[model samples]
Target chain A: MAKKRGRADIRERFGFAVKARREELGLTQEDLAAAARIHRTYLSDVERGTRNLSLVNVERLAAALDLSLAALFGRVDAGADGA
Target chain B: MAKKRGRADIRERFGFAVKARREELGLTQEDLAAAARIHRTYLSDVERGTRNLSLVNVERLAAALDLSLAALFGRVDAGADGA
Candidate 1:
C-alpha cells in the first residue's frame, strides 16, 4: 500500500530538531517564536511535528536560532533514512 | 524592521533547485508530481517557490527526485544567506 498523505515521521523528526536546537540554546518556545516572528502555538506544534512548515518558516526558525538553513536541515538529515 | 513572514527567497531558491534537479533528471513537472504523488499544480507552485513545504512534502519530492533530504536541502542552503 502507498504511504499516508500526511507524514508523521517528517513532523516528528523536524519537530525534534527544532526542540533540540531550542533546548541547546536554552530558548523557550515563546522566545523562539518571537525571534522567528511566528506564533508561540505554531512553534509548539512545529516542535511536536504536528505542524507543516513552509520553507519561509523554516528560514525564520533558523534565523532565530542563529543557524543557517543548511544547518537546520542538516539536523533533519541526520535522523532520516533514505538512499 | 523585521523581515516579511512569507519568504519569497526560500520559495524561489527552493523552487529553482527543484526545477534544476528535475530537469537534470529529464522529468517534467507532471512526471515529478506524479512520482511524488502530489498534484501537478502543487508541484508547479513549489517549483516557483510560491508554496510552502512541509517536511513530508519535501521528503516526497526528494524521494521522487532520487535525492536524500540532505541533498535536497543542500541546494536550498546553497542559495540562502544567514549569519
Candidate 2:
C-alpha cells in the first residue's frame, strides 16, 4: 500500500497557483471571487494556502479566469507569486 | 473577506474526482502514478482524500488519465465512489 500525502500540502500548492494567476490577471481575491462565483473570503483562503477548493469551484474559477486546469496548475517555481 | 473553504474539503473533493476517473478508466492508483510520472503513494493519498496535489502533479495525473481538469472535477454527488 502506498502512503498518502497530507491534504495541507496539496492545498498550499493550489493556493499558490491561484494567487499567482489572480495577480497575473490583475484581480484581487474579491474580484476573483465575484468573477468565479465564489466568496471573496474563500478566494483569500485559497490564496493564503489556508483553503482547498471543490471541483465545482475550481471549474468556476477556471472558467471565470478563462484558464485551463493545466494552466491553473502551471509554473510551480517558488517565488513566482504574482498576487 | 469571504470565508475560506477548508483544505480538507478541497482535497476530499479532488480525491473523489480522481478516484471516480481512475475507476472509470479501469486503472489503479499505482497505474495512474506511473502514467502520470507521480509517486504511487501520492496518487493513493490523492485518491483517499488525504493528499493535495501540486499543479505539476495534477497535470501529470490529468494527462496520465487522459482527462481534462473539468472532467476530473465532474459529477460531485455524494456516495459516488468509483474506486
Candidate 3:
C-alpha cells in the first residue's frame, strides 16, 4: 500500500513555520498580513493551519517576515540546535 | 472580500516545475520515482496537479532530480529567455 500525504499535513507544517517566524519577528498575524499585502483573516487561517497559501503569497509572506524563500521552506531538524 | 488560493494552484505549479526538471534530465516519471524512492503513482499525482508533497519528500525529489531545493521551488517568470 502507498503512503498517503494530505493537504492538512502541508498546511500544518507551513503554519508552524509561519508562526515560528512571526513570533521571532515579534509580529502578529495582522502585522504580517499587512506587510505582505494580504488579508488578516487569511493570514489567521494560514497560521491556524486551515489554509494552503500559494507560492506567490508564500513569497510575499517570506518578504514580510524578512526571510529568504529557501529558509522559509527549510524544515527544522531534530538536532535541537538553533542555526 | 478576499482572494481565494487553493491547493490545486500550488500542486499545479509544483507539477510544472517537476515536469520541466524531469524532461530537462530526460527521465521518465517511473525513472524519477525510482530515483527518488517514491511510488510511481504518487509521483504521477504530484506531477499531475493532485498532490502536495511534504518538505522532506520534496527535498528527496529535488536531490533525485539533481536540483537544489531552492531551484526546485523558484518560480519561472514571464520573462522567459531561459535561465
Estimate, for each residue in B13-33, the C-alpha lDDT of model 3 and write its tens digit: 677778888999999999999
DockQ of each: 0.52, 0.10, 0.15
Clash count per candidate: 1, 4, 0
Alpha-carbon error at B37 in model 1, in Å?
0.5
2 or 3, greater by lDDT: 3
lDDT by residue (B16-58, candidate 2, tens digit) is 8778878999997778888888788878888787865655566
The RMSD (Cα, Å) of candidate 2 is 9.3
Which lDDT tens digits does candidate 2 get at residues A13-76? 6777777777888987888899888888888887777765555566567667776554664532
lDDT, residue A64, model 1: 92
User: Which stretch of 10 consecutive residues in model 1 chain B shows the poorest summed lDDT?
Assistant: B1-10
TM-score of each: 0.83, 0.48, 0.54
RMSD of 3: 7.4
Q: Candidate 3, residues A1-83: lDDT per residue as tens digits?
A: 12233223546667777888899899978888999999999988887768756556775777788865556766322111222
What's the best-to-worst order under DockQ? 1, 3, 2
Off by over 4 Å in 1: A1-8, A81-83, B1-8, B81-83
How well is each residue in B1-83 modelled by candidate 1, as lDDT tens digits? Answer: 24443334777888988999999999999999999999999999888778878777887898899986778878877755531
Candidate with top TM-score is 1
TM-score of 2: 0.48
